[model samples]
Target: MGETIRREWRVEGMDCAACVASVTRAVERLPGVSQVEVNLMAERLTVSLAPGASVAAVEQEVAALGYQAAPLPAPDAAGSAAVPGAAGPDRSEAGGHGHAHGGHADDPAEAGKPWWRTGKAMLVWALGGLVGGAYLLSFILPQGQHWLFLAATLLALIPFGRRAIALARAGSPFSIETLMCTAALGAVVIGAAEEAAIVVLLFAVGELLENVAAGRARAGIRALAGLMPRTALRRRADGTTETVPADRLAVGDLVRIRPGDRVPCDGSIEEGRSALDESPVTGESVPVARGPGEAVLAGAINTEGVLHVRVTRAAADNTVARIIRLVEEATASRAPTHRFVEHFSAWWTPGAMLVSALVILLGPLLLGWDWQTGLYRGLAVLLIACPCALVISVPAAMASGLSAGARRGLLVKGGAALEAIGAARTIAFDKTGTLTEGRPRVTRIIAAEGAAETEVLALAAAAEAGSAHPLARAVAAAAAARGIAIPPASGAGAEAGRAVLATVAGRRVAVGSPRYGAEAARGGLGKLAAAMETLQGEGNTVSVVLADGAAIGLLAFRDEPRPDAAAGIAALAALGVRAVMLTGDNARTGAAVGGALGLEVKAGLLPDDKLREIAALRGAGPVVMVGDGINDAPALAAASVGVAMGGGTDVALEAADAAVLKDRVTGVAELMALSRATLANVRQNVAVAVGLKVAFLATTLAGLTGLWPAILADTGASVLVTLNALRLLGWTPRL
Candidate 1:
């Protein structure tokens, strides 16, 4: 019984998936540590531990596993989460192991220097010179020329040999470094000293190249952190302006944004008008106009006109900050392919070593090869099956896809959701605020024989004054605009999906669906029934006002469908996805909207009804339920992937798995396409990683490929998959 704390640390020295696993297992074994997640792509580890455990203890455990760990920087008041690659490479600099693995080079001053000047690169060049010189000298010096080759081999093994010995002392005697060292030493034993020198030098060069390519792939994420300005102009109440750090801004503070200045915080415009370039937040090519009451996000450039904006959210909690967090969280989230690769590598490294041993022993016995020939072939087999490429493929692709989606205004929560979206077969959309504009308006008012139109509207508005339902608000807003005075009403109450009741002018007045009026009036609404039917048939949601046992009036409200609803529906259908509209509205209104959008309709659904429907839809395949109301929360959670509209209730947004930040229904199709493409990218990367390893393994086992090609294939596959994954950062659907 202790309190739990969560901490994040940047780890170094992880070259492959096996290193990630090793660090994870070591940290998980510590007392009071409950959860440990290692993000190989981000080079970050998050741990949840009880109060009894200390951060120092966690760091020690990771260091014991042959990696260095350090705490991440504290989050600033502006709420900007540290993005992966924001600082370029592991925080510990791999603890003096040298940034030989792909990351930002260790010395800040030396980073601008050429790669040839780095210690590791210089060593490779030196070994290459020595090996080549000896090979040339052997043609002239016939006596003890092999001694020079041996010297080069021994010199080449120094770096990897040191790492191997260090890992052996740490109890992880079996690692990729150990395997490579064994292969190099085995070459020397088999009288292939020159080949050993070549393999070692080539391996070093390949690693250096891999590091440079991987750094480029990670640069895309780091670029997102630079979008916001460091300082902003604060408008004080005393009519003076002062420039302050963006993080110092608090909610309700007024800020003046001049033309060509980036917005400092997420806020609503209070004065002035301008066109804002929201491409950073929504990826829209054009600038959107902003005026009073319209929200502008931090990081958006104010294109024209000075705007006085009242800060609505702190710097850290702004839309841009949240998007960065979402992207990072998604990148850290693992997919099924990533998990399978990690699991596969757990046994794969050892198994590859065992196979190498078998090759060394059995090749001489079965194929009539000499011991030196058997050892040489076995060493090549070991070098070819390193699994570095296979381990990095899935994570690299996942990070790219998640980052791309965030840039385009789709916030996929994690890698699991990204992968799950590709399999979604059915997408259920909540009718109001999702397919149609959530703004309902009073279009028609029909009064009874004795009731004046204005009188009935005032009474209905009075009865609905306390209700928050969209229909009620429509009636209330219309009454206010028409200058109809609302009389004093008491005991206002709401019945979900039905009516609002209040006592108006000493008579009980009820305003709601026709069924409520009919029941309250005891079947005296015969005259209004026809009018109700006509309005309902026209797709208007008719509200009946009953007072003192008689029907007073009927108000018909219409919520117009979004202009892009049809296009969004068609886009999904073209992708072979079935779109269904679920609404609490009656069948007629639901059908009206669905028919216009060419979608299947399920109407008159209570919240529970929608949940059941979502559950049933899941049986077909993965389902994505899009909604914007509290009633949709259950269904959003029930579906395989829940996509919440940006304008939705907070409950719905929290319940959903993903969110559409632009509040456009068409974004759903865009999101689906992104997910599909991302998963496709993941598959392509996995295939490349796996295919290259298999081909090289076969060639090396047959003695048709040597250590040079084996290491080249391994490094080449890693670079190819990384570059391929980076392509997704620029991917955009034609639609």
Candidate 2:
């Protein structure tokens, strides 16, 4: 048996893809490092070391490269392992994958089990006590409800408060429990126990709310990951299928998929094909056909016909597998601002508690105020300082925004990304899959002078019908859809990719992936520009036309149009963004999708071209890039803002700022709506937090305010802010 050693480290300053790669390569280059994966998206790097190597040494090595690596953020600090009665971890940060550092997952849970502290039973008990305690105080005694509530509150607080006071006394008061102590003790001392109990009780409620929201926000990714095919049908020399672990699958492995089964990983068909339901990955309702040599994705369903795929990528690194990884990574990564907030509360809550105590004590001693008055005033200050508004606001709003986006088919990976989108005003759309349907479909066939549209299409269809290229599929489908009767397709003489050169009913024709199709077209490249310009307006791909080796007509095809595309783009524009289309397709196809969606179009772009274009667009303003699956991965990573269809591949989503969980184009619009609303709520919460403080300070200095009022105002503000943030949960953009 091999000896295994693992360690956790907080990796820092790696905010880019290159940074991630650098860390990975540096660690892997080390003498004993077997595998080093730096998840910049999760802000953590895990490296498998040989028997004698230390993770700390690797951390130092990465640090030498100017990337910081330290012990992973504590469960109580950040990263995974759940925080409760405090702000929960960002969705991405709370899971297996995140930007935060990591702990050995196989190690024992920090508190014996993740549930020991954050479990539903503890949550229910802790929260129910607060509520039940608050309720008892509020109704049990009218004349001294405050006193009754104070007693109930103190009893509740004592169990937790003593520890907080001790921690604060020990110079570690800034924590969820300490904050509770300060608020509860202040209320009891100042004769405003009801408010204090209410504050703690409501804070508990917010914790419960946090629990529910966290579960919902995380459920989407978990569900997606869980949906992966559990087993694959391995093809053996006997030609029989046997069940096998998907991980054991390798390139060129023969696998079978039947009706209602997902294609196991991305592969090219070597044997059979079918009409596949790629709706899970493409967001298109229509099932698409696949034939010999066509690549099939892991998560796509085979609606009809059997498929024997020769795997192209290993199951672990398959399209769907990578997509899930990306989603997890994106979710785990936190934004710069979120970190600031997390750290801010990690220190602020306790400081306020101390200030409140001084107000209670020093006020009476220095100013000759009544002990009761000073005590009451101190309690008020403590209530105000609970930070219910601050702690709950950011993550709550994020959770709601994420859930809302997911419902609309958009997947926002983390709190930071969700927050970032609200600030993006310019959106760049990838023409192929993001805006136009990625698959090429024939929309129009143009005839040369004196040639009939039907005649031209029939010729191409008949010629292409014998070919297996996409252009052939489009030509055949178009001819059939238009009710044109095609002569039977003949097996052409020539190797595949050269040209399916054949004569259909005595008319010479050819169709191929590239030049062969062009050679068969009559007009050659001369009519290419004019033909493209005309067809581009219709948002379709245009292939060349040839008749007896002279270019004669133009063939136009388009990717499927997203159902809510025009409306989604319009909605984006309404949000004050300009839409631009970028694609790897030829200029004709690019122009076609761009013109239809009214976006500025750039065609024939390589990944680098897409990056440069996005850079230029960002020079004008922040840009939102929307795409689907992995082809859009690079541009999605490059844009000022990246969005992916949730139904698409996870890699694009990992590279994106947001994912349309429902994979509906309109989800992008809804994401904006939710984001704007969340920002508004955050602003309102800040106002409430600061405004109450101003009033409390002024009243205290004037010698007109006491503990009871301060407690009420502060506690009330906390609840109010929490309520406001929750409003985002219900937000909708009429579109």
Highest-scoring model, lDDT: 1
Each prediction's Cα lDDT score? 0.77, 0.60
Q: Cα lDDT of model 2 overall?
A: 0.60
lDDT of 1 by residue, 78-177 (tens): 5444433444332222222233432222343444445456554566677779888888888888575767788887877776676566556545667566
My TM-score estimates for the predictions, one after another, are 0.90, 0.57
lDDT of 2 by residue, 1-735 (tens): 467555555454332232343456567766777756554333557667678776667866665454446565333221122111111222332222211111111111221233224332353466467657556655765676665566666565654554344334434434445545665675555556655666655544444443333333344444454445767898998999899866567677799888889876788888776898775654445777889988777778898887888888775566555555555555445555545665676556567767878977898899888987777666556555655445444544554455444433456676676676788777777665567555567777776676678877887777766554445677787888889998765655644324456687766665432344454544455645576667655555666555567655677776776767888888888887677777666665566566667767787666787889989887876677887756677777787667876454445445566776455667777777777776776667767766776787678646687544554454455555545655655565675
Clashes of 1: 4
Runs in model 1 lying further than 4 Å from the true structure: 12-16, 60-68, 75-145, 165-173, 462-469, 485-493, 499-511, 514-521, 546-551, 647-654
Per-model root-mean-square deviation over C-alphas: 3.7, 11.2
Least accurate 10 contiguous residues by lDDT in model 1: 90-99
TM-score of 1: 0.90
